[model samples]
Target: MLYKKECKISSEGFVIPDFDFDSADAVIPISTPSITQYEFDSFQLYLDLLDAMKHDKSSNFYPSILIKALKMFTASIISQKNNIPNELLESYDTPGTLLSLIDPNTDKTVFLEALHAAIAWTGAVKNNSAFSVPEFILFLIETSVYALSDPNFQYDRNIGNSTVALLRNILFHSNDAKFHFINNRGVELFSSLYLEVVGDTLKDYIIIVIINSLDVSPTPPFNFVKFVENPLLKSVFGYNLRSATSLEIRLALAYVKISPECALSFLNHIEIESSGIEFLFASTDTQVLLLELFEFLVTCSNETVVSIAEKKIQWNVFLPHIPMSFDSKLMKKTIQVAVNLFKIGHYKILDTLILKVLLEMMTIGNIKIKHRAMDAIRILINSGSPHSMDSIIGHNIISKICNFLESDRKDIFKFCFEMLLFIIQFALDGKCPRKVRDQLYEAEFEAIMEEVCGCELNEELANMADILKEKFDQLVAESETLEMAELENNHEIIEEEDYDDDEENEFHDNHFDNMNYYQQYAQNCMKGIEEEDESENESDDEEEDEWVDADEFPID
Candidate 1:
């Protein structure tokens, strides 16, 4: 009795030929045992031929000559229904002998023919289930992984990749095979092999195996592919249309889904520099998905998990994708990541670009995105990366945010005042408030703050505004105190405010220290961030230089 053969792994699913020996017709019971034995003796010659060729390939003529003969003769063992594979399996060592021939030194043609025979033996469907022979299946996988691991071993990609597909098929179809695979850290060997192996077929198979394994949390024993595998972080990031399918972006998503901890393990300072940020430049779906992964990593509530994600995923990397998150439609995940970046409080990322997106989001009628955009802007101020709004921090911004102060959207009014306070704070702190002070006066900043003081808003918002209104009056009075005295006292103050000058990152940490609730909202999304960090500290080594080829991308 084979287990459920319907796996939604690929378009053409695998038929798991896991036969139960308890079933009546598990194997054809040969009535004449000696007759079967006599026929089995003949197929032993094929195995012997492989063994002898392995010992001496001096007659290179003969072994190359025997490649087809070996494939046909060995194929007959299962294809002819001669009971040879059955009799051979009864003895433990025989199966290993057939598999042991899969070697780096073996002729590619002869080795593939032997692998074909192994597949037939393992995949033989009617009675003899290949799954029942775990010893042989495991051996074949172990050998194939070794042969494929050889860096110097190069073959025609079609042949090489066909070898990968044939081996992948055995695992593709059987749960028992997959169990042996994951536990043995088959991912470690194969991910390394992926860098060395040629052929889109093999690359495609490995990517599927990885996505299938990491995408879903399998039950015990199969749960963590990370236990031994590297997930080939370096290679996946460096991929181009010339090297692999664009599905690498999907691989990044599956990888992040593993756990925040798992993400940081390979997402090192080095790895992050290589590829994670580039996904924003790919297709829109890819950009949105990549943002979703960043949202998960940055928003995890677990302090340790959050720490790992934040350090590796640099905030400065996301400037390009931020605007798309504020698109006319609700790109909820993209905004979530943008919101997270604000919460993390990196001033390098919270620049004029974000201000533009925020202002645009406010005017759009898309209620869903508008609210999130509002939340993001409020978080940005509350996060205190206010210097970014300095370039255009004047009457236009003051008037726009003040206009929303009347919005009934549950005190989008509260943030309207807060956004104003930040502009005021920058004016005073950057020591260059004349322009902003004038804009606030032009926008009736005092009257608006005075009115907000009377509105039914939260105590924090009210108190924060009350403190700010007084500051606004002082700001206006300071501007008028004496333009000549102000200029004379702080002549260089205006030029000192350039963010790109010598004092760039120098100001970020200082501003973040003032943020009222910088990381407070990130924890709110913790429930959505999955916890698959079963082994956080497992180490992965770097892979060798890539074996390049293959132009096809996987279909969605």
Candidate 2:
């Protein structure tokens, strides 16, 4: 190396250091009475290093990306160990230097070394070292994803194991790291890779990575439905819940919200217990996450998952039991998940018990959750899930919807208007259950439509209102005929009962024949009674004739 420490003893007996020899680039050079530029030239090596990095990078980072990054990383790390910021010694581009190590083209051999270096440095720099930046974590994850995809790395299971292990530290420790990992598409790439590398070797880590992806819930979501559809993720997450570590099992609960299909894949190995429900559906801490997952899952349109969520796990049954805490953020999200479940055809989620919970939430005085609940009911009302509309009408929801229709809060007003509109259409269609529909007033709904027609409502509500008014008018026109039909039906029913009464009279008039049987039965009963009386009389006469003057002659 050009920079090294050496000393020579001259005849004068004082040690003089080599002019070119140096220990660190950031070190200050000796001062002279007249300072010259040449004596301190060595101090410029950091600039040279950066130039070299840029030069090598321009030349495809000569030899390899990992080597270039590691050298720069080593320099900064050495500087950082000497109570110096690596940026001061290694130039501010040191983190950028480490970034090259993760280029997807990195070969398997270099990648293995790179992963080890990444993992080691991750812990080494924990005391506020330069490598401890969030970008470093992102680098490791990006490298791991690339390495997992590299065909050269496929032969080496250790590469995957190391990459996944590194990810565990990065993902579990830092939310920012998790976010970067997800945004980097590490979830999907890792999900895709596990299918290749998993021979019972890396499923745990890969699944945990995808599971944590749901934690950050990265945008442009990993095609969870697409993965399940291909059986790619299905096979990757195919392992039993029993085979998973407690941590993996626990983190995987996030999947229920993200992809019920994948969660079902995990449960295929074991039956989900009540505890599973508690973790995913009942935990207030995870309510937001559960809600997020539900929000994503509904869009996937997997009926099997809906079936499991509704029937097997009984998500709806436990939902009402989960208290609507004053934490409106969670309550609002909870309402959203409930709406998602309703959308997925878990109709029982609209049961009065749960609706009561939602209604209470709407009235809880928290404007956000109130609006959220109102909007949620609006969604249910417009969901066209016969039960959604029925839910609005069946319980306290209709009143709340009507009252909120006049709310000064425009959002509530809009939501309630939409709800009332949908209910009117629902009632007009006669889709609602008789009892629930009975709770709905045609006139109240008609009046709402009339207002929508007359008011300066938005074009959409106005048009729908006009259409509904026409339908309502037609229904009203038919009501008189319908009532006449109903009267005739009742008349036919009354005549049928009178006909039955006449048949009864005819039977009474023909009762002589019936009375003959009765006479025989009565005569037989009287004859039997007379025989019993005569037998008792004869017994008494015999007892009297044989009687001694004793009062207890009956014993003889």
> In candidate 1, what residue range of length 10 has the lowest lDDT sum?
26-35
Across 402-424, the per-residue lDDT of candidate 2 in tens digits comes to 55454445555556556655665
Compared with the true structure, the alpha-carbon lDDT of candidate 1 equals: 0.54
499-539 per-residue lDDT for model 1 (tens digits): 45547665665666645355555554553343323223222
Candidate 2 to native Cα RMSD, angstroms: 16.3
- Give the best candidate by TM-score: 2
The TM-score obtained by model 2 is 0.45
Q: Per-model C-alpha lDDT, please? A: 0.54, 0.52
Per-residue error for 253 in candidate 2, Å, reads 4.3
Scored by lDDT, the top model is 1
lDDT of 2: 0.52
